[model samples]
Target: MEKVLLFFTAASALTAVSSLPARSFYFVYEPKNWTEAQSYCREKYTDLATIESMEDVDILDNMKDLSQMVYPSDSYRAWFGLYDDVSSWRWSMSDSDFYQHDEKEFRNWRPGQPDNYQGNESCSAMYSDGSWTDVGCSYSTRSVCFDVKGPNSTFVLVNTYMNWTEAQSYCREHHTDLASVRNEAENQKVKELIPSTGINWIGLYRDTWKWSDGSSSSFRYWRGLEPNDNMEHCAAIYFQDSGRWEDWNCDKKNAFICQNGFSQKVVKLKLINTSSVDLNDPQVLENLLKQLKQKLKDQGVDGDIRLSWKKQSDGNIFMKNTEDIGSDRDVP
Candidate 1:
């Protein structure tokens, strides 16, 4: 009987499922304010539901019990986990080293500007006079690009008119990135580079809406003129309005949704067996699985991990290699 040494091979087949947690939404008919609902969900399940796509919206719509959602008017709603983050504004140039202390907070916005006109203005533009204003990202305009070397930076005005996204791409490809007006001096330098007449796109932008569980989904299914009120900071799905989203006051009590589940991952492993003991034996395989699981835990791998052997066409997990007598193969 030859001694068998088991080792993992480099060509092992490995499959990884998405790390995002699999969630199941539960509709709680009990009316509760946004804050209370959030607390209940956190204590009972994972957190308030974070709908990421139209498919998720449909799921919620199907699961909701409209008869239980009693109200005086025809409108019926349920709170999920979307909210307006009033202080989410920031510059597109994210490199922290490029900005000095308090430079990132510097703002020279024109008065009564950045009202998020109609809840669509998420990009920033610079006037020839050196003031900034929030505008729709789709609006085409001339842009300023900047190049940075060590502690020095140079601002260049792009003569071509383009949307904010296009301008950002052009700037990144040709120069460093869109010009970041860190302070009054940098703002003045960028403003001087612009033509004396028209407004130009800048590096400032923001995403006002966020999920309670901190999901970074940009999906929005708002109804017409929805999110129109600035005072209504929280979001809900209106059942009567074809499940479209609407901004509502956070204090308003309503039924809510909660979600639960852990993220799952799948991995395939191949082992080279050099032991005299049969690797395919049920007792031996179970012991090997236990050892592998313990090893994973010892290495600080969190969450539940399941291990099982992969059976071949002959229903055996371990196969002898006659051509390569030096090694036997086991799939798991």
Candidate 2:
């Protein structure tokens, strides 16, 4: 009987193995502006550095070599991934079902408003005239809350003054969520709830900083009085200040840090088929892959594992072995 030698390869998918670190940081001494550094990182690695926690900060702090970098104006700073996204406005109630069509993108900003004054105004507030403006999230103000019952919704004004986050919490605990003004009508409805001269908190808000790799990490380690300027939208790590973060102009050239995640590993496997089943048959090959995946899972292999058969030049996944049949074993 001819022995079919099944050759296949397995690769790691999007999720890396649990034992491996999520990201590895690299400090590049070459001076490049923030945009240039970002492009380089995306081309060579995953993206510019995305510091997720204090541990990541420490890792980067130790990896930086000040002697290798050229001091630009005696500044001991290096660009990382955090950047201000000035147009990322969204509602606090993020459930897609709550909005219709472009209602999610609805805005009633006052003219020349939402300028993100001082680079710290990341929250939205509605005035008595039904216009919205971005304000600092820490500003205490009365908030408008909403209660939804089926398709009907009603706005309520919370008389107690609180910060944006506190108001969101209060509204969530007491009502459906903070008021989401979906249209001119809803904006007017919410505006009516506020006092004629009051600026009240609404569900509209925007994230000031975002990671280059699109990671939603809220971790921040800023130096005192840092990120105080609206023009300085890019973030950098200050080696001289114990690796604390500071905002800078993106156009300024500086040494930068990049991060990389675990790469996909291609593994070759050879299987000796002893049964009479057609090993190259599409259904048979698919079943075999499922069984192999289960076997790997049973043997403690984790993460997203993807298996595919590598067809030879003749377009066949399995070839008849001329040598003596041997026990099943992986080729590499």
Candidate 3:
């Protein structure tokens, strides 16, 4: 009863341990500007590192140890994923469903919209009749919610008046976040859901930081007096400054990090009762993926995994006109 397990051989012991697939960072020593570094990464590896959370930053910081040892003659300020977008309109919700086939870039704004009127109109809202406008985030208003990836493409219009931030919290808790109108069709649906009356908050906002690979991760890690919002500037991590992020001119050349492998895994599963819920809905597909991720973690797997649908060739999340089998694509 008192005996304890022991590792007889290092190789066998290493083989028995199961850890989540990690997004590893590779330090490239050659000097290149932001765009050139990105090209190099896409050609050889995956893409530029999209640091989503402190964990990602920590991983890069750990890699800094080896970077120091190997490239002592080089500068540690390397390029990551943050960049200055020519446009300021960004989605507040980071869900990938909005991204299927460049749908996220689709906009149904009224002419001269996102006017950033008064400089504080950072949040977006849609008129009950279907056009969108940017307004002050403090303005309280009703909001639309799309239960995408649910029983149906459920669009719920919450009548309670709340500011944009509060509306976001309410919608996220009840259904998904504030409605994300992907295209004209989806925008029409949202318009129909809300009365042809008051303004309703949607999931659009303005921000300068965007990912190189078109990811919408809103995570930011910056150093002292950083992100001065300089026009046309890009981001790089200063290794000497504790691996903190800094905004610099895009033309400045520096050695950078390349993340080559996908943090996602695609697994197909067959199921019954296909009519219970519309798995084709992005929100529903995302929720099911989350459940599967939790199930995996419950079985002693890593909890850092995120789940989403692996779109089919036709840019749909679920395979239609086929048996009820689906793919569980994990996001790191």
Candidate 4:
């Protein structure tokens, strides 16, 4: 015996169940200048999107129902985080760490691509699958968002002598914000990277008459003759020097200096006035003794402080000291 099962039911159920990729829908924002596009993506989705492969670029290239936002440029190409200028090759718009992102091959650049276009063009775009183009840094265009899963960041080392405002503008031109000191250790390290005579612009700027990091300008240590809002509006600290910070105008152009290393061993002390001396006599026995002790402390010493003194013709005395920590402050 054979049995046949038949159903006479028909609806649009199969047609309504259309197929879709697991991650297909990508949101497209309106065209914008490179800076604005970068800011928008960071605020909404992620840092400026970085396409890891030709396949990834192709995925974005295939989007159909594109719309515009922010700027009203009719240009079809949009900015992505890829550039090959020998001047500034890294992504200019992100503070996010780039070291962690899995390095991707540049498979989309045309043959002999990114020759830097007479050493000027430092920006890149994805025109279509297996196609990429370089554009001027200021050209406006739409930008894409990425569903970045891992850590994506960048580090900036500012080596300019500008007032805070000027430093910021410079960073913006390169698609980065002013440098921010995240911690006390980082601040110390920054100070050490600068010179003693000139101020190197860090992220700190003068908010009104007070020096400030964008987050907090109220709290700061101003160097002598600094926070000179009229002349200087930027700030920098010398390596291992214990004076403070200074402010300078952002526009004044000057060369900057920097150094990198592990946490600098610092020696902290309180200067106690044991005796009084005349204003003119900085090397008098009373003043000389106290000053020498302080100088020795600054050279990184505490217990069994030993120093050799030298008297100069200008009535100034300098001291050299050596120190070794031997357990307790009360031991000696």
Which consecutive 10 residues in model 3 have the weakest lDDT in total? 7-16
Expressed as tens digits, the lDDT of each residue in 1-332 for candidate 1 is: 33334444423332233355578999998888899999999889888998878899888888878899976542489999998875677766665566777888899999988787777788899999999998889999999988888768899999899999999888887887888888888888987788999799888887678888755467899998898856687898899887998998888889999988644434555555655688778887777777677766785654556666667799887676555432321111
lDDT of 2 by residue, 18-103 (tens): 33345778888888999999999988977898887798888888888888765746367899999988888877776555578788
C-alpha local distance difference test of each model: 0.78, 0.78, 0.68, 0.34
Cα distance off (Å), candidate 3, residue 297: 24
| lDDT value, candidate 1, whole model | 0.78
lDDT of 4 by residue, 106-200 (tens): 12344665554533343453342323345444444332212122442233444444433444455655533443333434344444444343323
lDDT of 2 at 239: 90
Candidate 4 TM-score, true structure as reference? 0.21
Clashing pairs in 1: 4-274, 4-275, 5-274
Model 3 C-alpha lDDT per residue in residues 214-258, reported as the tens digit of each score: 555678878977766444368999877778898777877777888
Candidate 2: residue 266 lDDT (0-100): 36
After TM-score superposition, the amount by which residue 191's alpha carbon in candidate 3 deviates from its true location, in angstroms, is: 9.0
- Which regions of candidate 3 are displaced past 4 Å? 1-26, 50-76, 83-106, 110-122, 127-131, 134-139, 142-160, 168-200, 203-220, 224-234, 247-252, 259-332
Which of 2 and 4 is the better model by TM-score? 2
The root-mean-square deviation over C-alpha atoms between each candidate and the true structure, in angstroms, is 12.1, 14.7, 13.8, 32.8
* Clashing residue pair totals per candidate (backbone < 3 A): 3, 0, 6, 21
Q: How far does residue 43 in candidate 3 sit from its true spot (Å)?
A: 2.8
Off by over 4 Å in 1: 1-22, 53-55, 72-74, 218-220, 224-231, 263-332
